[model samples]
Target chain A: MSNNISLWLRYKAKLVVTNVSWGLLTFSSRYRAGMLLLFLGLTLALFQSGNPRFLSYRMVSTILAQCAEVGLMSLGMSIAWMLNGIDLSVNDLANLSALIVAMFLRSIFRPTNETVLLICSLAIALTIGLAGGALNGLLIGYLNIPPILTTLGTMSLFRGISMGLTEGKTISRLPSALAVFGRTTVLAIPTPFVILLLSCLFMYYLFSFTTYGFKTKMTGLNPKAAFFAGVHTKRAVFTGYIFSGLLASLAGIIIIGRTLSVAYEYGTQTYIIFALLVLNLAGIKPGSYDVLALLVAVVLLQTLATGFYSKFLTLQGGPFFNLFLWGLVLVVVLALSRAMERWVSTRS
Target chain B: MKLTRLLRHEVVLCLFCVFVVLSIGSINPAFFSLATIFEVIRGAIPYMLMGLGVMPVMLTGEIDISFVAIAASASLATHNVLIRHLRYQGGLAGYLLIGLPMGAFLGAIVGAVSVFSGLPLFPVSLGFWLMLYGFNLFFISPEMRFDLPPGLTGFYRRFLVTVKDPVVGETGLHLAIVYVLVVGALLAIILRYSTFGRGLYISGGNKDVAIRSGYKLGKLLIVAMTLNGGLAAFAGILQCAFKRFFDPILFRGAELFVIAACVVGGVAIGGGRGSVPGVLAGVFFVQLITRGLVYLGIKPVWHQFVLGSILLGFIVFITTRQKLWVIFGRRKR
Candidate 1:
């Protein structure tokens, strides 16, 4: 038995470990970022191959807009994930924020003073989002409720409030001023895309350069340990949730500006799953994630979604087939990442 | 000792059930009838089965959101193959035979992947959840399939026990409730009497102890997941049969909903504790609130809010009881 075991280990268990491919594929952040970009380019090319229109400047603009919505969501999701928690209510909170702002704007019945209306809308959306996040933080951090359960309850709660306020009616025909985020582009860049870029940068700075961020990471990694280390873990957690809420609310504002409407049913739950997929695709871990990778993932997903909506695979179930492909992509990404990690470990 | 045991999670849920029933009954005195009880049971059949199906996986201390995916794909596949493809005119037996194994097979695939990949259960299951649903949409018909084979046409109206209601005239308990009873009793028995069941608890509660106790930890985990997947699929198929149609998006956002229901039933989220009774009471409680709202004339918008608030309050109460006792009771550790 010992001889057989030794023989099997020697031959059957042999792994073809090499650092050459590993170096380019995943050795450093720079290489990994490049790899992700190359992969993104490849996906774009493949979809373009199916339809020439898919690669057009018009398509890129649409992709950027879609990317902003998903990008902001993933960023919000990333914050919760960083704290070793999840924010299932982000999309719901976004919708609710937008709804509140819409209700405010609609009650005024105003088309006058566009600047003031936009500012008030922005303030309402952000404040509502912050309050919602505070509620989540109180439950999860101060009260010691599990993040998932708390968020799950809040997910429905926020949407319920939105629905109750609206009586399940969509608020449309908003003041053109409220649609500033969706309408205006700075230097040929969509305003939503600009918002996404600024948010990403701000979040990156927060995570990388702040003591609070460090504390948050430690708290998420091991709450007891962080607490014992005098990290004020509850505060870190509370703050983290607050930030996620803010991010989600921003996404809501973008949606309102872009669509010029708000409703309880907006964003839907698919946005939650898609945001999660972006996190997964970006290879996020607690306390550590690549913001650029997140952006790339959002763009990639948007392209895929657009392609499907445009019937890229018309021969094979058309638009509906996109879901299957998304699922497949999730599985394949997991497998490939695992393989990469395994290869790295076998190097020793 | 019995009284002390009764003070646990399930008992609290039972009390909550009474509270809900009394409040809802006050709002609509008509809700105090046996017909409504039978109706609630009929509506909760799928929910109960799903609760029962998911319990083992949770007991093993691992979350499996993929079970819904398992259900969607398996039921869709069964319908497509048996009804759409073969045009079989057989009864529920043909559907079950095809679906149960197919569900089990899909579950086994989940098990095999989780065991092989050695990733965290949540993410693996999450991946499968998306994969299976997408697969169902991509490969199976994306549209809702209302065309039930001749055998299933009568299945929707089929009931085990009929009742005479004063107002509605005729009402009956659904036949699918049998699945819940059979599954619940069987699961209850298995969880209590079997070594495999004990192994799940042992492993979930403590991996090192489980390893030392002669349990095949890897194999046991896989089996638990498979059972969960298979049961979820079964629940889905039953629900589809009863609804008389199949949709690709059936239970799309229900992952959290189902898990929240199961966890509320006193199943320890970290594993090692749960009961069939607890699960049943949990589902009954949630389903009552869901169905009872329509009768209360409170408008559909407020229903979700009320449910969320009540659910939140319940969890808060559960998590804070010890603290509350410390505050109000004799304050000593």
Candidate 2:
């Protein structure tokens, strides 16, 4: 019995050591930005107001809640940016999908069969997302329009279609079933946060363990070399956009559920900025740790926003101040990351 | 042969512009009136100015989307100063003196940052765009509308030339038309006949070769971006003067429209292959479509959709047409 106990103890010790080493390796690769963000977050939480409101459970949960949809969109955006492409239309795609789902839920069905309605709405939203992504992929990959311009055109196109369809009005009173995924909590965690965690895991797998992910990275690193190596460069580009679109649509579903309504201009104000910020802040070589980096960035932004709002509740132009702060953060983060890269390169 | 030599891409664009105008006029006779033409020209001024600004940057193989934000910021600052001077007797001169240089300075900043950072122009400009926009919003209330001083307003409303129309009321030509003509002509000469223009083309065509040839590429980029900023600011001033009211969102998406105009006019986004005349024609084409849509009684929401479609179609056509022609020529051979 004692021999068996010793053996078990050794096994446990080996497992713990391997796990800790794996985490250390992951954190070290992204240590510069990750450490900076953690320091900032902790500093703000501890000292921003001297009241320590940021350290509260309520504040933590609020930041997580606010970050859910934006985090999901950033995950999608990172995939595209990993391939050295961008999707400026993700926010609009999310908005359009949510609007489609909202319109159907409000006009076509009663709330009698919640399960069936939920399934149908989700299917419709996903289809819209897939179709939008397919269009972007074809235009960019097959037709060879620059990603920026193609996405720009589609941004306007999607926004215009949503405006026309909804006549610039908000669609509300969505079925409770739809809201469950966004609004309800499971074991004290927000449903949207749970969804985000699950999606991040799926994305981590898709980007790390899959052949498609390998092809995407190869294509982004050097399209000419990737092509010569028998990777279908165009197809890789196509799949990148599709992945972005599908994820954006998933974000849309979460948004509609959380807000309990859908508007044409939903997510217009901040998702693009957030996505760009997270993608740039995390510095685009995707790995398992990227998921953690994105979450940290999103929470950091949300903390700053919430902190400012609470501290300056009566200030005029408060919202604009938040926007200015976000822009400043983006610029500073970009500069710092670049400087760090140069410093590390020189030292090495 | 000489006539054909003159008929390059600009001529093709001009012909397309004429065709659009004539077709629209035929559909609605009201569109042919002098008032309609002047109206179109007035609206086209801002776009033309922005295109001219974007052209040089494109020639340097860079882009500056922050011009719209710079324009907005300049306009807001000028408007605030003009309002303060309302108690004192000052004309448009005070606004111009303050606004023009301020615009140019802001443009120079954008250029300097782009040159210094060595980052891609698009992302940097996007950062500036957001920052400037937020700055403007913080300083000026977006919803508040400020009227120009009465002295400047009266002078602004006066027509440089007027024709009395018994049926359609008085159709007066604004001074903006003359401004457009002078600016367009000056830009055309500079682009076609100036050493700076040659440098821009060479740098854009082949950066390494341009470096070998002893051109100061960084300075050239700075100058091009500064000029773009100044022109955008001037356009913003024109927009405020024409509208006689200041709103923070006056030129919200004007950058995209102006860039679209440049692209439609055959200005390659990659640079080194565009002319002032081509850009001007593009400005006219976009303005004509926008105005024509109004005359056709289409809903305003459809305006952006149609514009985006037209831009996409034009780019696709321009890109593929050369390849198609080459293929047919090879078959003939």
lDDT digits (tens) for residues A1-348 of candidate 1: 999999877775453343355565555434455666887889888887877778776678877977898898889889889888889899999999998888777785554777777787888889998999999999999998877778888997887788888998988998777667986778877889999999999988888898987888888888899999999998998988999999999999999999998888986756877887788777777767688888887887787777767765546675455656666666666666766666667753
**What residue runs in model 2 are displaced by over 4 Å at the alpha carbon?**
A1-33, A40-44, A47-49, A109-111, A285-289, B1-8, B85-88, B140-147, B164-169
Residue lDDT tens for model 2, A1-348: 999999999999999997785565456445745664765668575554676555777776777787888887888888778777788889999999999888877787655787877788889899999999999998888777778777877887888788878878888887777878686788988888888899888887876788987888888888889999999999999988998899889899988888888898886846787788777766665322366677677667666667777766677887776666676666666665665555555544
Model 1, residue A1: C-alpha shift (Å): 36
Model 1: share of real contacts kept = 0.62
State every prediction's TM-score relative to the real structure.
Answer: 0.91, 0.90
lDDT of 1 at A234: 89
Tens digit per residue, CA lDDT, model 1, B1-333: 354466888888899899989999998898888888888887778778788888888887777788888888888998899876788888788878888888888887877777776665766677778778777887887889998888888886787788889865678888887778888999888888999999988988998999998998779878887777678778888888878899787777677667767877887776888899998988888888887898787788787787778677767876787587567545442
Model 1 segments beyond 4 Å from truth? A1-17, A28-30, A44-56, A108-111, A307-317, A346-348, B1-3, B157-160, B214-217, B325-333
Q: Each model's DockQ?
A: 0.49, 0.40
Q: What is the lDDT of candidate 2?
A: 0.79
lDDT of each: 0.81, 0.79
